[model samples]
Target: MTKIECILRPGKLEDVKDSLNKYGIHGMTVTQVIGCGLQKGRKEVYRGTEYSINLLPKVKLEIVTKDEDVDEVVKIISQAARSGEIGDGKIFTYKIDNAIRIRTGETGEAAI
Candidate 1:
């Protein structure tokens, strides 16, 4: 199994989720996060005072799938999250040793 983690712009969440659903990959965990990368954050002005916001809001999606589906899943996420600009975020994959569904007591691929 493989675990795919995607960090994307908050505005792109719905697009990514819809794309994944169309591809039949539905189970996932979504989280609101703060991070900084190549975009290096941004500057803001509040009450006439300028400030640097180094950490930006982001949306994180975690999905676990069979190993063979990794490539397609990554492609779907990439296409959906891209904006032709910096801070588009990143995607990462990790090998999953095992998975267990607590309620059903299912394991391996079945558990996912």
Candidate 2:
């Protein structure tokens, strides 16, 4: 199994989710996060003053899939999130040693 972690602009969440669902990836975890990359954040104006927003808001997705599904999943996310801009975000994939379902005591891919 492979674990795919995606950090994307908040506005792209819905599109990414829909694409993933249509592609048969139904399980995922989503979180609101704040971080900076090469974009180095951006400036914002509030109350007639300019402020450097060092950490921008982003959406983080955690999805675990069978090895064969890894490439497709990445492609789906990439297409859905692409904006041709600096802060479009990134995807990271890693090997998953095991997955266990506590309720049914299923392990390995069955748990996934």
Best-fitting candidate, scored by lDDT: 1
TM-score of each: 0.96, 0.94
Tell me the tens digit of each residue's lDDT in model 1 across 8-100: 999999999999999998899999999999988689999999999999999999999999999999999999999999999999999999999
Overall local distance difference test of candidate 1: 0.96
Listed per model in order, the count of residue pairs whose N, CA or C atoms clash below 3 Å is 0, 0
C-alpha positional error of residue 30 in candidate 1 after TM-score superposition, expressed in Å: 0.5
Query: Residue 60 in model 2: shift from native, Å?
Result: 0.6
Model 1, residue pairs in steric clash = none
By TM-score, the best candidate is 1
Taking the tens digit of each residue's C-alpha lDDT, what string does model 2 give over 1-112? 9999999999999999999999988899999999988878688999989999989999999999999989989999999999998999999999999999999999999998
